[model samples]
Target: MATQAVTNPVPVADLRRRPGRSASLRRIARKKPVGAIAAVICLLLILIAISADLLAPQGANQIDPLKNPRLLSPSLSHPFGTDNLFRDVFTRIVIGSRISLGVGFTAVFIGTVIGASLGIVSGYFRGKTDLVVSRAMEVVLGFPPLVLAIFILAIFNTSKGYSFRSFLLLSFAIGVIIAPTTARIVRGSALSIRNLQYVEAAESIGNTSFGIMRRHVLPNVVAPIIVIASIQIGNAILAEAALSFLGLGISDAYHPSWGTMLQEGRPVWLEAWWMSVIPGTAIAFAVLSFNLFGDALRDVLDPRLRQSS
Candidate 1:
């Protein structure tokens, strides 16, 4: 008779507790220059957007019709110089941040709410409902957002009551344009989460469909949606600017928007470079900050990226 050595098996739980190479990669990514710079720029832009009134030297729309000189070049007194209307370029740029941030966040919020709800429902209760919803989303996504917006604006401008209604319409149209993309992203996330063991366990415990989704699914799927929403904020801001540039957004002449400033400055870009340059630069910086911040956030939050990094 021979004595055999017995060995204990490593528990699966214990095996899973060890940090892998991916964790080290994430630590490296957090220290990267791009990530650090992006974070700083994004933070600065957010602060400016929040405190525009306090930071702006003058009223955004105030015109110094008597003392203000058209095509005035940049100087110590007027850092960015005055526009054709003698409005302070610096002040308008600061105030424009409020409009850009407001439109971007509002539009993205509306799109995400509508899209996430539809996607969760469609993905969870798939079949005919999913097919129909998917088809509708595709159709909406097929149209060019800018062209669609132009058409909608033209129609609204010709309507009997063409007033403040235009602003609401523009916001809704921008939201609708972005909704399909959000829906697709949410649907993919929900589909993957729906088949997980925890979800199955909830189902076995007689949890209602809605309850299971609310309690187990939404919380798990929200991270990606949030990243997407943040990224979309920049896109919405750009879209609003494009619409206003073409004279389709915010019809009020007194309203001081970066896009409207660009429109006013375009004709005089060569002669009065500051007119377009200041506002254009503002738009560019704002959009770039949002994008960079979103990228960093996505890398930080994504499980695969986090693991690999």
Candidate 2:
């Protein structure tokens, strides 16, 4: 008599989800305290960017050297004080959030698309394809990020500066800089999935490579990609700031980027500290928020990290 073998069954509601991989916001907040704070800071930044026009008391570039005292220290009238041009420093900082965060988000999106495509294809195919891609990524990593960014920007001749087109050009340059790092991380994760039993089973069943990658490999790599993409956004923000500081990125006249603010404050920093300090602080907080959120996300989502947690 062939006896039917029985085994313990998971609850239907639980399904295939692992114990620590809760997708609930409450769970995230309870499990990771720092992540909650980062999430709040990031949310505030986005809200400020979105509502810059309404929130800012004055226009970002509304200058009145005679009406408003230049380089006035932080006061009731000007919370962040005034720049040399007597423009409201608070207004510029508020407006700059839009440009800074815009560049960061856009650059990460571009990097993710390019890096994930290369990594999944290379990791799944292996052999010559893997070798070629690995070498190319290594070559890209060899160049200094700022140098590579400058080289790419030169191609566009963005000396004209601060238009919507220039904004995209800057984002694309930073995206290219971050793509190799993203590819390296993604490829490692994909390689692990490629050797899994289910993937081999799919291959044995004569599934197409693209089908296998999409159905099996891509889904598995998504967690790592999310973590990587968030961290890349922080890097992109810093990169854009650096370029703007060098007068190579967004124009201060059109868009008052934190980096441009720093450049403006450099000469007057000795006497007017508010100009540099305020914008520099903004950049630090923005980067820290994203990076901390990325770390927290990785701890929650990555199985290895979750085990340690």
TM-score of each: 0.84, 0.90
Cα RMSDs of all predictions? 5.3, 4.5
Q: CA lDDT of 255 in candidate 1?
A: 52
- Residue 26 CA error for candidate 1 (Å)? 12
Over 21-63, each residue of candidate 1 has an lDDT whose tens digit, in order, gives: 8876566456565765766786787788799889988887687
Best by TM-score: 2
How many collisions per candidate? 3, 0
- RMSD (Cα, Å) of candidate 2? 4.5
